[model samples]
Target: MAGVVTGDDVRITRKVQQLGSSTLAVTLPAEWAREHEVEKGDSVVVQRDESSGSLLVVPDRTLVEDAETTVDASGLDADALGRAVVAQYVLGRRLVHVVDDGPIAPAHRDAVLDAERGLMGVGIVEETTEAMTLRCSIAADDFELPTLLGRLDRTETTMRDDALAAFLDGDAERARAVEQRHAQVDKLFYLLLRVLFATYRNPDLNRAVGVDTGFPLIGYRSVAQDVVLMADAATDLAALTGEPIPATAREHLTGLEDAIDDAADAARNAVVDPSYADVTRAREALDRARNRTDAANESLERERPEPLLRLQRAVCALSGDTRHVRDTLDVATRLTFRDGSGATPE
Candidate 1:
């Protein structure tokens, strides 16, 4: 039997008594057992916490259940109602009830619908004058973290490419499509956040998804956020310059674009296959990209069109985002290869 430590650090001492020739036993504290609603012959799970070297005695009756929360949205505006619903979803609530004692305002109902559209697996299953019910249809096992990350990466890459092409070709329709696709990126990101939060809270879920022991959850979350930010930067870039880019400015922008792409590739490699060498290469690439962006900005004439200025700023933002990604990979690499002295591997 394992020792139990209470929150007050009070250690419960028990003697190991021989029950028979082959059996030994330790009695549990009545108070503790009663608190957990343990009864005679009830099943319990005993597992060792590898990190803390503590034995955990968990009641097997603590079943994983779908959680529900009701938000009293009485008199709340549309934005507030939307934020409240999103908060519940992010908190891992499977079902959310947005209720008003009186008739639900049309604006408030629209807000709930908007929130559902923005999030993944969330939908309004039922709505009435007094209440609206939002359900998360996605199961924890529906998708794995690695697959989500891969999809996010691919989606963002496509968005970036399309945005660039739209800008260069002056395709207003394609630009609108790129903007619309950002919503898709947002969906994947929100879903990934939900999964990451769940895995962070439950070790079983973490292990089930095969998260690397050396890779911190926060690091993965940061990478996912960085990917989204890159997509946002692409969207911003695509929004500028509906007119065809001038040949002169386009040449400079293309160099900056290529540099950003190279830096992104290096950062992705460092994160997916972490090593000191990969991180170092990513850092170097980002540095070169930064210098190139500065040179490109200088090459643009001071009297250039407003759209070109916006494009220049967008390129700079993309460079900044790529640097952020490289920095995240740098931290991930250090965490994965820390020495006994806590120093990163050379």
Candidate 2:
């Protein structure tokens, strides 16, 4: 007799029965089977969850087509409707239909449109007075995790560079543009998260998307999140540049910004072509960024202008982001090393 795993909780015991000569079978729990509309001659999918070593039995119909969810927006407000759509998106739904009894409120309609901007692959495909259909156009075969992550790295690094330039040159136009690019970073981050969650829920999705690797999914997901945080830090740095600062503070800021840029470059190299040497270089860059931050703070006079104080805060935030990048580089380097040698360290 082997135990039956019911849903994500509870367990039941069942005995394996010999079927003819070669097949062995077990009965599904009566309650579970009934709830899922399983009957004799019906098809069910049995998938093995590698992370937990559990067998998952799901209805075949659930997997054969894209899942469509409908959100009733009859009473909920604009923000609530937006959050509902986001929640469904995060849960890996392929399509969401928002419906109301009458014409949808202007605020709610605007909110739904805004959500499409914030999320990747989500867009309004069809809309009427009373209903709207939002579709997630991300095809598993088209956007692989590695490809999306590479895009994330590029976008974040560019944002960081532009932010630094804006701050050093006191260019308000460039600073505003830096802020605009944060939206793209956010979209990419959301897309990466959606792919990660899809892979976790259905391991087959990973293979379908060509993510053929032994590396842990959590590691990739963490690195994607870190990249998003780095982009946000760069946005913060750019925002500070709209105000005027003393020339002395700008001199210190230059060193701090350059150190952060070096750290970004090292991290990018470590992820793309990881080696022990690149890992070491990334670590050294982080150390350099910390030292530069300290130097920048020390160089400020007692009568610091508001802009200089803001710059100091941005430097501290940038230092924290560099540390996060260094941590991700450490994981990537180890994975690359292991894959290359086929050996685990003692």
Candidate 3:
């Protein structure tokens, strides 16, 4: 059994005593047992983290029960109410009760509906005058983090491509479509956050989520955030494309776009497969993206084209903003460090 350590480095310890022949046992803390609703005959699950050599005990009962939270929609406005529901969802709450003492206002009800629509696997099952119930059907074992992250990667890739195509053709409709897909990235991001939080609480979920409990889990979160940031950059680029492009800037911008595509692709793929070759490719791709951006910046400076600042910023984001992906390459790099074979799913 692992010792429970709390604030100020205080550990709750128990003395071990002989129970029977070749058997020894430690007594559970009465308070902890009671708080967990652990009765004499109830089963408790003990999970061990191989990386940290720590054991966690949880009541089996809680695992099977859906976690529910009550959100008092009292003084909160529509936006705040929506955010509150999202917060509860991200915290791994499967059921959220949006309750008001009296009849729910139309604006507040609409906000709740919007929030549900934005979230993955979340739906409204019950609605009444005073309260509404939102249920999240996301099971811990249903989708793995790597799989979900890969989906996000691909979705953003398509979005970036569409945005670029829309920009080159001066198609506002396509650009608007790209902007709308950012919501898809957000849904994946929040769902990943929820799974990560759950796995941290119960290391047993690491296998279910197809990620290691330690750095890989944290690294997945980091990479997901980077993908979201890249989407923002891509969307910003799309919005700017409505104006006429200078011929000189166009060539450099196109080069930067290709460079971004290569770098982002390699990096995201490495995260999924995590081989030494893949990691190296990711690193080299990012380096090339940087060099491409620098060359474009120099060219723009020499030409002094119209909308120079905006063009320059756009050029920079292709490498500067999107290349934030490089920061997460360490995840794949480390995984490949032990063996070029990469981490196998538990």
Per-model TM against the reference: 0.77, 0.78, 0.84
Tell me the lDDT of candidate 3. Answer: 0.79
lDDT at 320 for candidate 3? 60
Which residue pairs collide in model 2, if any? none
Score residue 59 of candidate 2 by CA lDDT: 69
Runs of candidate 3 with Cα error greater than 4 angstroms are 1-27, 34-62, 338-346
Specify the highest-TM-score model's number. Answer: 3
Residues 180-273 of candidate 2 have per-residue lDDT tens digits of 9999988887777777766655555666655533355666777888888888888888887866665766666667667767776676665655
lDDT of 3 by residue, 136-185 (tens): 99977788988899899888888888877777667899989999999999
What tens digits encode model 1's per-residue C-alpha lDDT throughout 1-346?
5566667746777788998899987787777687777799997766554345666565654334447889998868889999898878877789999999899988998998899999998888888889999999875556777688778888888887788778878998988898999999888888887777665545455556646422455666778888898898888877873777766667666666676676666666555555556666666767777787777777755546556666676667556666667666665565446423344554
Higher-lDDT candidate among 2 and 3?
3
lDDT of model number 1? 0.73
